[model samples]
Target: MGCDGGTIPKRHELVKGPKKVEQVDKNAALIARWNYCAISQRPLRKPIVACELGRLYNKDVVIEYLLDTSPEKCIIETAAHIKNLKDVKELNLTDNPAWKGDKVNTKGDKYEDLQGAAFICPVVGLEMNGRQKFCYLRDCGCVFSERAMKEIKTEVCHKCGKPFKEDDVIILNGNKEEIADLQRKMEERKLKAKLLKKAKKSKAIESCVKSARTEANALSSSSSSTSTTGGKAEKPGKPVSGIAK
Candidate 1:
């Protein structure tokens, strides 16, 4: 596939199912890659399969709608519902009646579900984290806790190397687990980039080898033709002064 203008033309809609059925409600456009547990913590990614509910939900609030209904339910969903962290102007939770007040007031930032999420109520809400935050918890690599923002003097994304709200900090538990996950994601990206570079270099070398072979063959053919032409150009001329015939 090639790009005609600045953007690549829509080649084919990568649907989740083998056959596109009107009965099935799915994002008929874009490709998705991951499952999102929460709209607030949607990984910076797109999922290929949009849960059946996602089809019924509005395009803007598909994730939020899903989150509100069943944070626990792994509804078939696509990643396209998520917006990038940088695009977020504000980070607010849609009150999940089922999971609400599960963990409203806790010392640590770790909570099991929306009930736990509700426990840590955000006092002053703001979107300081970049657009990537909306994609997914993994991609955003953010660990700003709403509690940390309230306790700390500054609101900055410790992971992203930028300033964000203490109350708005996307809180991952302050534990070795969070740190390790961040490190692992970073390492994964570095490895992917390295592999891609290596592949490109290998391809270039193969192309060079092919070109060299082509040029060699062309020269051999041209030389043979030139030799035959020279021989013909010099007429036999009666065997060139044969020896004392």
Candidate 2:
């Protein structure tokens, strides 16, 4: 029977257990990330990567999409200035068996269900949905949880066999402090590259100028010598010109 006053109050009105702030945040982030691939407009999958601009994409998707460029292979950029696979380090991402993220949830999926999924770290199995720290090696591009890198402390890349140093590691979407450091490094590198290119162009110009000057000098010398020889071979102005002074 209904209460004499009115209907009963709902649990949400009375109970104050916890909030869904974290879940809502995660849901929004994943929706933004997984909506589409930047280059191909395809669904994101394993071995995803981010460019220097920090746009996420599937490695395979980029490869196929780049085929359209043909002879002029795609010139992609990342933190390490990638041009191709050689320039990019294949990410060794972990598989989240708990949540495959394959089944399309027409309706909004709960945040807890997508936890540690979509993109997980190979070493620590942590989700890359902005909850924790993660980094990719500039030399190899192998991504790993910040915790794993800190705890492991190895010189070699965990995904690839290539050797790397502490400086080769770049954090993905790091905090303000980390972003400041990365920004400084990127700016310094770009400045150095610009200077080096200018130096090369200047050297090329100088070489061309010197070559042209040398050719002009040789031609001038030859012309003068030819004229002098012709004048000397005039046979002392000949007998016909004897009347001349």
Task: List runs of model 2 lying over 4 Å from the truth.
Answer: 1-43, 53-99, 104-113, 123-131, 163-165, 234-245
All models: lDDT?
0.39, 0.67
- State the lDDT of candidate 1 residue by residue for 1-245, as single tens digits: 55556665553643444665556323211111112332333332222112211111123445354345455755443334333322222322223234432244567665333212221223333321221122112223333334444454554443454654322222221235643554455456557878999999999999999999999999999999999988875545666676776
lDDT of 1 at 208: 100
* TM match of model 1 to true structure: 0.30
Candidate number achieving the greatest TM-score relative to the actual structure: 2
RMSD of each: 23.4, 9.3
Residue pairs whose backbone atoms clash in candidate 2: 89-140
lDDT of 2: 0.67
